[model samples]
Target: MSRRLFSCFGKASSNPNHDDKATTTADLTTEEQRRCGPVVVELFSSQGCATSSEAELLFSRLGRGDFKLDVPLILLAYHVDYWDYMGWKDPFGSSQWTVRQKAYVEALNLDTMFTPQIVVQGRAQCMGNETEEILSCVASAPRVPAPTFQATFQKPTPESLQVSFTGALRTKVDQEGVSVMVALYECGLVTNCPNGVNKDKVLANDYVVRRLEKICSVKDISAKKTLSGTVNFPLWESFNPAKCGIAVFVENSSRQIFGSQNFQLPDNI
Candidate 1:
């Protein structure tokens, strides 16, 4: 059976109760600071999918700098390749992302995978286009242990970019496993679809993931081991440094994200 996409619309706003100052102020305790960690939202979508355009717009608005949210919001749009053969091909679609979505389906134990599906903090799923449902999930999301995460990017050569990250779990947990994942995303991406269900429509996408790379994995949580790695950037010919950034996150065996951070690329790079 073909999967159906859900839709809804409303004015965008941030969580008011979130304490952004907790992260920067010395007055707050460690627990208070961890409460300020950003919520990670992953949207599995495709340009060729009939209902994905609306979800793309919703996510774009949420990722905007001027949205004025109290808590940090980290959004990633992963385009899947499964729909490309249906007349119009999605330029950003990737088979790797398709596999990623499938992995989520298995983790969530869902019978089927569909476009315009939003996964919050890698722990909850909702209809991508429904602002209320998405926000509700974000608000009720369980607070996971925060980890110290840092990332840096530089253009080593005209044809290549280099990225490095360092992280250490800050709190104790009894997880069976953990893995660090890094994603490269670009904003202000525009595409004009001449065919398919969205024929003749222009779509704007934000935080659209260009590549996702795994950094490392951990088996023992009791030990405080620092995780670090340097990787060559997955260069996209159409990438604009002004609209690109990186997100680093740590996920456990059950696919629950414990911590995450987002960094925008330097303008000159």
Candidate 2:
């Protein structure tokens, strides 16, 4: 249901039983000077949506390399809070994610926002559960050199974790209002839904966004662009470094992503 149930309207695949249909072929390559990075696939989902389980499952497969994709993928799932009022209060849900999704809604010129939506490189979108369409979007998205960054982790306090990163852009980049967005994500999560649309269900989620921070602003990322910044994340109960990781990407004013990279958090952190 829409946050404003009466006024908000959106489109979704009427066919939830998405099949393993073949997808449109794509060939993406770059000059040797600057090779392309992995595709950044962002899924807007909620644990409260009954229909989101399928999409979540598919995302797990994509993250775990269950599919033989030509290009690599850096997957992230943002759980929005609008569905909370329906019954189940999703522990992962947040209004910040809702704002982020709305930004995509405006950028894509969509009628409204919808759950189980996949935005590829911030350029193309499709129903999240539609396997073929999702792969097609990934295949066709424009490519760019992967963003490069080095994460430095500091000793953590009981309540929060602080980390810093230094990055460089070695190739031609032509985007304004560029920002570095860092996300702390988790995998292999299982939740027992006790209320609402997903009542009495055991749901699994991966690449779930636990924290998102736009760490720095760079007016011009072309040429030898260099930047460094730090972000602090509040710790959650039962947090395990082994299950968490970081994803870094570059995005422009239009919210179109150019490249992304993922780094695993050290177990000793």
Candidate 3:
């Protein structure tokens, strides 16, 4: 799919269900207990980059709920295709993801693009291996608005799953140009590399993005202004429902993230 955002610069581009369940807070981490607002961490990485392993592991820990932080953390791992030219081609790599990263490069005005890069809440970018810097960015991220965000999941048939998200814009940005996006992410993935810089290494990954869908664009939004959309996904034979989840976030024309929310898929279904 093309990685274009309708209201901004470009255009871009599920489901199986045996169960129907309206998600609840219990299906998600307890955000009410968190001391800070939601923080979205995007990792642009490649299996061919040796340094990406460390960052991937760190993201795995966060996804596993090992962090002691007081904020809600939403992690996403976007495997870029740039490194595939190496001996080993990353099975998860996508040129669309590479385009997404390049868009960020222009948005953030960075010196150059590199593997194992981390963008925190779309406000700061740092070397993915810089653990201390990553933590500081999360610690200082702006607080998102309260429980105004909502996500609902349902399986109307055995072959499809439908997800609907609703949330309000808690903050405003310049030009009043903003867009909402919903992403389906999978966790607890492992890949064994036979060739490339990471040859012979078994890498564990989480919050690995499987798909990203744009919801809508807002020319202007005031506090509590609602943004909502529903997306349908086909259930693939390779999908492990228990290891999946959803993430939703708002970004401005400049690609700065305003806030985000996430929820885990219930095992009962």
Top candidate, metric lDDT: 2
| TM-score (all chains, Cα) for each model | 0.83, 0.88, 0.80
Q: What digit string (tens of lDDT, one per residue) describes model 2 on residues 4-80?
A: 63111245532212112111113433453146667899998988777789999999999888889877889999998
Top candidate on TM-score is: 2
Give the candidate order by descending lDDT: 2, 1, 3
lDDT of 3 by residue, 69-102 (tens): 7776888999988777678898788888988888
Candidate 2 lDDT for residue 164: 93
Error of 1 at 231 (Å): 1.8
Residue pairs in candidate 1 whose N, alpha carbon or C atoms collide under 3 angstroms: none
lDDT (CA) for every model shown?
A: 0.74, 0.78, 0.71
Query: What lDDT is obtained when candidate 3 is compared to the true structure?
Result: 0.71
Candidate 3 global Cα RMSD: 10.2
